[model samples]
Target: MTGWRAIIPLNLGRERKTRLAGRLSPSERERLVEAMALHVIDQLRSAGSVAEIYVLSPAEPGFPGTQWLKDTRCGLNQELAHVLGGERMLVIHADLPLLDANEVEALLREADKVGAAIAPDRATTGTNALALRDPGAFIPAFGEGSFARHRTLLPDAAIVVRPGLQIDVDKPEDLELALKSGATSIACPI
Candidate 1:
């Protein structure tokens, strides 16, 4: 079988919050974020199970073997459609360095049965990852309370709740937790 495909929307715009604001300088923080993204991409490639891997950004990411698609005005929803290509789509964030490829594979396998599945943050207030059998299922409402918004969008869609896979770096404390938890590889370039 061709299996499913994964698309990582790399929010490379400079406005992201500093995960290590107090511990690292501004330049170091930016570099750290970039490294984390590369690490996740590398792990995905190592799995060699997913059919395709694309990174969505305004500019082409320097990483090799990744399909770089220019982000549209609609943000993630548009990018999800471009990469999904009618097959099952696993929409993940590049900031999640500690993701288990097997978990991703499981999500893909499960997607074969369900219409959609989403991985929410620890707080269960925000969405960290989303999976859909149809690319059109993506409706971006990413913000403080996006978890509810997405659930509303896919009222009939199945939900696959995973904890570790849902951890995404956002605040400075999150970065420290990732590093201290030995999932630091998820913070560095793979």
Candidate 2:
């Protein structure tokens, strides 16, 4: 209960992953989103530093165990900003299909040493995972070029670089990358 609270912000709306529409069917996209979200939840559950997992989405709690938080309908950054206060928090994107226990532990270790930690995407321009010890003082700034913005905002934050932490499925090529990396079944936590 004293450890960091993990939050995975999900967009379960009709507009989810519209960018990938040309590459995948609507149902396929939804399945991919659900699988990745479940994968993220499972990874958090396996990690020792994660005290609790919360899913912030407008949809019902489709996944078990994690507490459901009704999204504010505001964008991710604004909604997450409201929850960043009063506790140590980890905000991770749900599309990381390769995330495993070791990467989560490493990110936590880096965060513990510094006041905060950030895992940038493969392009090193976006943030895939973020951990904040004194979250009350840090605003969630997730968007285009977020990695540099976050680093500039939190100078003491450790930049954690790992394969699992960096790969996130955003474009059509990213899906190929994940599949090539053997992400055959992301929801199978076992």
Candidate 3:
């Protein structure tokens, strides 16, 4: 199978990661966003199975290796639906602080086997990473409780479970988990 292309949707706005506002200052949240996004991108690059990387956001985060696709303000689902390349599309969240190359490779291997794979967030309600062998066939339904939506849509999809792929920082508790996940970064260390 061909190497996968990773699609990372980064929220670069000042209010990015607003859920963490109570736990982190605005600047801290921004830094956390950048650091986590960069970490995800770094892992993707390290994965030999990933051939390319694309970042979808309003403003470029200045990550060097990724091709920044100017978001059309069309929202996540629509924007992802429009992305066209890559033998297969790997849609991964930027807040996955624990994500590493091993998870990326593992997810892709499962995708190669089943044509589709999903890594549910720690709570098992949302999707943290998705591998679509046929990108056009899936519309990228990511939001609260998205795991069930994708699961219902693609019943045959392989379910990939791993700490590196299952953890994502979104809430106050999630932030703590991320820090404990050996990611002592949230703007120069939490």
Candidate 4:
């Protein structure tokens, strides 16, 4: 597998996990976000193929080996587009509670075969992890039904399905799924 940089975009403002409001308080939600982001950075650091890890956000998440970039807050796609010019990179969501080094390595391995690869959510509608040969190869569309949208845009990209990469905690059910999937305590309890 080729070496690649990982970019994680975190929106700590109103844009962060609004769907979890019914289950977790504002502070609890923030803690969860930070925890998951840290977990992702840690996993990337441990991954053999990961060269650098970058956290793009309004404020620093302060993980030990990550480079923090100031997020323009313009939107996920635009913010990502600003940082990705022509380098090979992996864009991972911050809410992936079950993410680990193995999953990242698997994704990169698949990318080596297909130039680009994406791990869609369990429902196969949302994109949780995306890898590209060139950052600008395709614009990232990461919201509702984004998996299908991304596939449409990058028809040649391989589809990698790993449980850890597929399970990003967004709703209460998602959190439960992560917990059942052996996700450790990265954040405090709701």
Candidate 5:
């Protein structure tokens, strides 16, 4: 049986996307967050290599075909560590609006070749997606220069470069890039 599962960590805080506050209103940011997260889940569902999809958040996202785990309101690393066990898993960020099923399949295929794999952001400083053959292989470092940090932890892990997976919406420029790349969400029309 396949032991691979896709785990998405969502920060369902009211202040989500604070970086975009200067441009978008609070309600708009919230809606965009929800829309992008749902889009990510949809893509993961369509990926044949993904055995299951799980959302780890403080509140229920109300998405079907996904198991929601009520997070402990702790930091990202701690929350992820709480759920890590003896299972092969892929940790995907919820902000990848352009993420597609084929990209996810390619990531899984790469992970199968290497014990672990990571897709770094455009700046090559942050990690957008991480796949591990064993969840407990290394402690997850997910903030600021995480790409290099994760590589330090798992030196042999493959570094994948997929355009769709790299464009995570964190700043105003990121949103613009995602929009220009044909990213569509239920909240904001393309």
Candidate 6:
């Protein structure tokens, strides 16, 4: 059995904004995103998993102890393969503020057993996390309706249903809901 490692796909852009339209200023939204990332990373490191956490983003001096994939040409699948190095991988989106270590570990364990697993977001359109023993499963299909596509590809993959894993902050309504519930982040603290 292959050991489990984590791959966090972070699209670090200067003008990144969580709120759609003009709900929040660009700077304010970026700051909130940073805070959420920090919180999530801290929680994951605290979990004490031997699995490596591969962060694919430009170097953020504020965040350390992460392996950054600076190559822009390396799409999500390539970056994931580069970081994970052919081992079983658990891929999680950076926007999931409520992603806890326990939930992550659960998905990893299930993947280990079933060879594939998926944690669908609230809309069931976007996949927040996916676990696969094979790197081929990490193809670049992360847009809407991806959850169903993944399920179609891997029918026997385990399905983990948890509110924390399902809720991802993509727009203002999502962020507001997460804030109201005091959602935690998956950011690592180095």
Q: Please list the C-alpha lDDT of all candidates, in the order they appear.
A: 0.69, 0.86, 0.85, 0.84, 0.86, 0.69
Model 4 misplacement above 4 A: 13-15, 187-189
Task: Give the TM-score of each candidate.
Answer: 0.84, 0.94, 0.94, 0.92, 0.94, 0.83
lDDT of 1 by residue, 71-170 (tens): 8657666556555657667777777756777767666666667777777777889877777777664556666887888889877655656644666778
Where does candidate 2 stray beyond 4 Å? 186-190
In angstroms, the error of model 1 at 151 is: 1.4
**How does candidate 3 score on lDDT?**
0.85
Per-residue lDDT of candidate 5, residues 37-71 (tens digit): 88999999899888888999888877899999888
What digit string (tens of lDDT, one per residue) describes model 2 on residues 153-176?
998899999988998998988888
Write candidate 4's Cα lDDT for 84-117 as tens digits: 7666699999888888799998888887777789
Q: Which residue pairs in model 4 clash with each other?
A: none
For candidate 6, the 10 contiguous residues with the lowest summed lDDT are 181-190
Clashes of 5: 0
Backbone steric clashes in candidate 2, count: 0
Error of 1 at 108 (Å): 1.7
Residue pairs in candidate 3 whose N, alpha carbon or C atoms collide under 3 angstroms: none
User: Which 10-residue window of candidate 5 scores lowest in summed lDDT?
Assistant: 181-190
Residue pairs in candidate 2 whose N, alpha carbon or C atoms collide under 3 angstroms: none
Instruction: Point out where model 5 deviates above 4 Å.
Output: 1-3, 186-190
List candidate 6 segments past 4 Å from native. Answer: 18-21, 48-50, 58-62, 74-85, 136-140, 184-190
Two-way lDDT contest, 1 vs 5, winner: 5
